[model samples]
Target chain A: MKTTNKIITNINQVSVDQVGIGDRVSRITARSVKNEAKIQGLKMALNMIDLTTLEGADTVNKVKQLCYKGMHLHDAYPDLPTVAAICVYPNFVGLAKEQLKGSGINVASVATAFPSGNSSLEVKITDTKMALDAGADEVDMVISRGKFHQGEYNYVFDEIAKIKETCGKNVRLKTILETGELGSLDNVRKASDIAMYAGSDFIKTSTGKISPAATLPVTLVMLEAIKDYYYETGIQIGMKPAGGISNSKLALHYLMLVKETLGDKWLTNQWFRFGASSLANDILMQLEKQRTGNYQSKDYFSKD
Target chain B: MYIGGKFPRTESGRYFTLKNAKGEEIANMCKGSRKDFRNAVVEARKAFEPWSNKTAYNRSQILYRIAEMLEGRKAQFIDELMQMGSTKKQADEEVFTSIDRLIYYAGWADKYQQISSSVNPVSGAFFNFTVLEPTGVVTAIAPEENGLIGLVSVIAPIIVSGNSCIVLASESKALCSVSFAEVINSSDVPGGVINILTGNAEELIPHFSTHMDVNSMLYCGDDKKSIQLIKENSAINLKRIVIKKDIDWMKDEAESPYFITKFTEVKTTWHPIEKIGASGSGY
Candidate 1:
């Protein structure tokens, strides 16, 4: 039998060495990918994106444009792959789903008092239910940082479990720790373990609303937790480093870190995803640069 | 040696030997590749907004500060000019001229926009006028002759208009360019406002012209083949290409408000006005 209960109980025992992580991340990022491999990495990163727009000002047209962008990406490059999914707020999930119909791009929605998990259990349950009812293939829920900081690990665990239960077996749950507020790398690792054992299908770094979002060092810590979880229960969990990863070169570095830490099995869209909006255009620009042998201008790319 | 706000070696790690008039090796200059040019353009683009948003008087003061720093290091520039085959008197003259050229451009910084802008009379109920704006980032190939004065002349005019620039220093006479970078660093001029690279103009000119992020290009040489290449590549982004051929930098005619206008774009605006009475609008 798997030792899920024991792992959850021992979450506090997981300590992250700040020095070791810093050195390893530097080494991983220093390994440059170039030429044909660079092109390949850029394409793979383009495919693994969860193009998100979760602003309070988001509208029907903006969500439609984002969904269209997810499918078309860049029509000039006929060989380009569409993004993995379209991420939006719950209200736009229905429209995004309608726009992305039959395009094979899943619709992900942020729910459960997203970016700030300050609501009650009933409110959180209703939030998840609203997203699922609107045809969200994935739900990105923020954990209760207030609870986690208060040493109420059980409350945090129960909240994620309740939302995962609402997700059923169909919808994947991406628990955003908002690592910028998590205080330390040790808390990040503990929070990763809690989300995984509480049945989160993906452990995301941030909600894109916080500073210090999804840094390479924090992503490494989460990946290590996922690796340990997989070794313990043989259940592989996905990783998504959302926010602030805008350029192609930095995206490649993240991919390198993933491959090195979690192995090749976690390299697909099903296992690894980037929750970013601007990252798509940048990757497309790099692909175009590789195709045309000239640096690209932002004027040519779409703003959405 | 200067990119972004720091002095860093070329990322390509390639170097070429610089020789004195006697053909003896003096120093190894960074053989900046297309990637270095690309990196500098990235920094220049990032630095454009803040640098351009600065008040004209502030930019004027910074340019004057560069002249002051250059004056303090006049002996070093004179020494480098002599190493590139100038006599003691010629070196002294070139250094003094370069410093004076910087001060000239500094004085022009806040005044050029006034002379360049114009009010136009339209045939409708509107006020039409035009004002000059910095043309984003510019890439230039410094003149091959008069090492220090030519570099100073090309750079001061372009940046005096609030445009950031990436300049390839004179290949044969590259020493003063590196020392000039030191002066720019110590001066109040912001980093990336002026990035100087030492490399072969022939190798870098194609990239300098074709870069989509660069808004304009300045070529100070008369090589027909290179000029043809620049004209062709600059078409990719429709970048404004200014070709200065056979210009003596030491002359008073070389430094003009027209030089600053070359790197500026005219933005014309029209504001609607209600007619007061049947007569034409009141002044």
Candidate 2:
């Protein structure tokens, strides 16, 4: 039922109007979400965070601190839900799992040479297995941008499918397009369709390593791709805008985009996540401000 | 200029002309809007941590660097001060005193901690001592009198103690502040360490007091209504309000290390000592 030829045929039919997308995104962002809806959106945004720290200098203590922070985000605000997951490097997956044990917080490990998919297929499989062996609930892998740029769409599709297969049915596979390197929105749409058809559980925007990681326009194109894929196969996929999304206002705009394009079913953490480290604290600060009717200082909050 | 690191024009794209005493237009300066202040505060907050965490010696060296830069541009400062209705003698004195005030505070930067902190005598088995810490971001309104010296006097103490500040220059005499910002820019002072804005104080003071991110405010002018408004609005975050009025900045008493203490917090620590049981050493 699934073939590289079919994937190419479907993607070739997909064309995105860049000018129209820009106009629509601007209009969408201009719609001000206020008061009650804002509070609700803030809480929902807080609950859907991946609370990530994927720096090269990550340590066991840092992962442990992040794992704890994911569970107890701003203890000052009672009844707040812990973040959906803790995203870390593949090496710290076991440490995060050990720290976040029984907390219902999923541990997501990045693989496939992470942020760059220039390694051999054999290495990618082993990289994914290392995470799985360390109890990672989700595996975020990158597609080979060099191959994708070379017009080898089949190679990219097969690579995602192989990683998805290795992830088994239990672990979700999030394919990082690293869209900043992909150049135009047309390439983004094409990459999104290929990643989806190749069996990605989630299609991520960036590895948080590149500039212009996640913009509303880019996310809109990917969401439209997910919408078209859903109509064709009746399958649902998650969307994550990682990196540089460090405030509540932008996160709320992304939520509004999701609800409008993909409807309410995709609003929960199961379908949406923010791949950010500092975003959690900013969200917490906003929530506290809402409760106390005052602005918050960064000093009161704990660092992850 | 001095948004983040590089010198930039105000984002509002508005500029006001600074006129000489003879009513001739001297120069066009950035008419900083609320947006510029907001941007500067963001940079100040960003620079606060590293600027605060630096060794007191490093801050001293930077403050001294500002004085060195100001001394080299002494002629330029004197000319700007004279253009704003100051006599050549007053302009010369203001520039000289401003440079001296900077050196005075630079001397206090590394030594203020030892002078103000104290070890407390506790009755129990505990070692207790109180140390001073910089109060994050401070916002000040430079006095209307003595533009160069007043601006330096208000700013030096706050930043010498390692608190980053956004200052509102004198409403009428703003050219010197912009020139001073250039001096600060050339000096090794980090961007956002000192942000100077030229604007109406009444329009900007409310924001200076009520901005949720600003930690402390230094009001150098004695406008009763403005002070009242600042006092009332600053209650939202319980911001520290330091109202300085009627004191001539050129006075020798104004150069005390105590001015540095105004923008600092005394943090007392209790370290547990080895506990002695009821059984004595003889027993």
Candidate 3:
């Protein structure tokens, strides 16, 4: 979709009802999913994960291990689905790409000065180019929070548009708003609108480096933006709530929110993704517990 | 009731009639299910770190506070015991003994490590010492006969060493268990440190044994089938199993530092020693 002057002008008028969103989220969380439906939700949440290892201490061995874990979540449990992607820093994109080959799992690499978009446009472009050249299937770029906070909405829009241009049509580009740094639900909605209009295939919640990475209310605001965007344009943008969602029950709650907000079309991994690392094992543990009539320990699952 | 520091009904919403020895209904107790046991284990695991990291002196203070709270509510416990068909003298003795047992374990809380841990001599130039650490979450079945005393006897020793526990109260004699839980709640004891559940041992034993998050299993009865089931399921995670079969809770032998040692693990650390001189004068 084209970024028109009309869209930029409409961004300011988009305000969120904080109390209403909170009430809606509470109602959604109160709905329980049990038994067979719970198992199915657990599996769906597992498949939606982008098993991530984005750390300064991350190494080739760690990335490779994470990729392996993404493919084979738990071998003992039959018919377990693999994770959708393996997320890592730009440097390990090629290694993750190689490790995930033929397994049908995508390799997602964080780019554009990820976690903190403090770099220049030239450096951000190089960062995206580096991951793309390494054959990263998806590029997760961070929005310039400094510029956005300064009310430079045009700069943020132009930056995402430029990165989307660099990615072209084949490669999907996910825009990380780093919602923790965005300050409020209003800013989150504004940023979500900017990213979608500027050609972000998916709008993500956080970089996972911030304290309050992904919260229910912030995600709900972003989902409402996605819904509004889908209505405006025929195109559909994915929603990804990354970081701090480490348990199966919370993950299931996220799935419930997504379903209630955006409907069934966005339930698949193609449209929804969890930018998390430890969340995979928790979901695996829940699945194993269901398979065997016993609660599982973290010792049994692989730590990636 | 009293799972995770708060009094909550069983998630299963099922209750069983508690009858007196004369076959008269006394109360309807929660028939705690596996899911309740699971939730209690989750709470116990959450409480383990903070509870175990508390100073030994603080743990002792908490245990002593529990004893004090029980002493304050002694008449209520005696009344519950009588309602459960105990003689007035027997009820009095049981409540007093339960209070005393808590005090006994309270005194041993900070001192057990001194008697149990040791510095060992090794061939290598290393200072090797073995210290006792509280095993994580423990699941215990309180003895069936002495409701208050058995519950106190099993819980005091296990928790004195900083371990958190989820205890299934005696099925037939459970009224005192709930009353004791009220005393514990009023005590300075942290929630989840001692979660008491009223349920059948036969129904909850398998879950108590199989829960992987539980570090140890303590059984207070002599049922061969239940003991064998605990033994077999404990192998799944190699959880430490302590079976107190054929033991009389009223005897002094029931309250021992050795009981505290059963729920603790020995962690030996080897620190390299630097030789001072050829004669190793620093040693």
Top-TM-score candidate index: 1
Q: How far in Å is the alpha carbon of B172 misplaced in model 1? A: 1.4
TM-score of each: 0.96, 0.77, 0.91
Q: Write candidate 2's Cα lDDT for B112-194 as tens digits.
A: 88878988998887779999999989999988876789889988999998899999888788888878888899988888889
Question: Could you give the C-alpha RMSD of every candidate to the true structure, in order shown?
Answer: 1.9, 5.7, 2.8
- What is the TM-score (0 to 1) of candidate 1? 0.96
Between candidates 2 and 3, which one is better according to TM-score? 3
lDDT of every model, 2 decimals: 0.92, 0.89, 0.91
Q: How accurate is candidate 2 locally (lDDT)?
A: 0.89
* lDDT for each residue of candidate 1 in B94-191, tens digit (9 for 90 to 100): 89998899999999988998898998987887889999999999999998987899889999999988899999989889888888998999998888
Runs with alpha carbons beyond 4 Å of true place in candidate 3: A1-3, A15-20, B17-28, B118-130, B268-282
User: What is the TM-score, restricted to chain A, for candidate 3?
Assistant: 0.98
Local accuracy of candidate 2 as per-residue lDDT tens digits, A134-245: 9999999999999988988999999999999999999999999999999999899999999999999999999999998999999999999999899989999999988889
Q: DockQ for all models, in order?
A: 0.73, 0.27, 0.71
Local error of candidate 1 at residue B86 (angstroms): 1.2
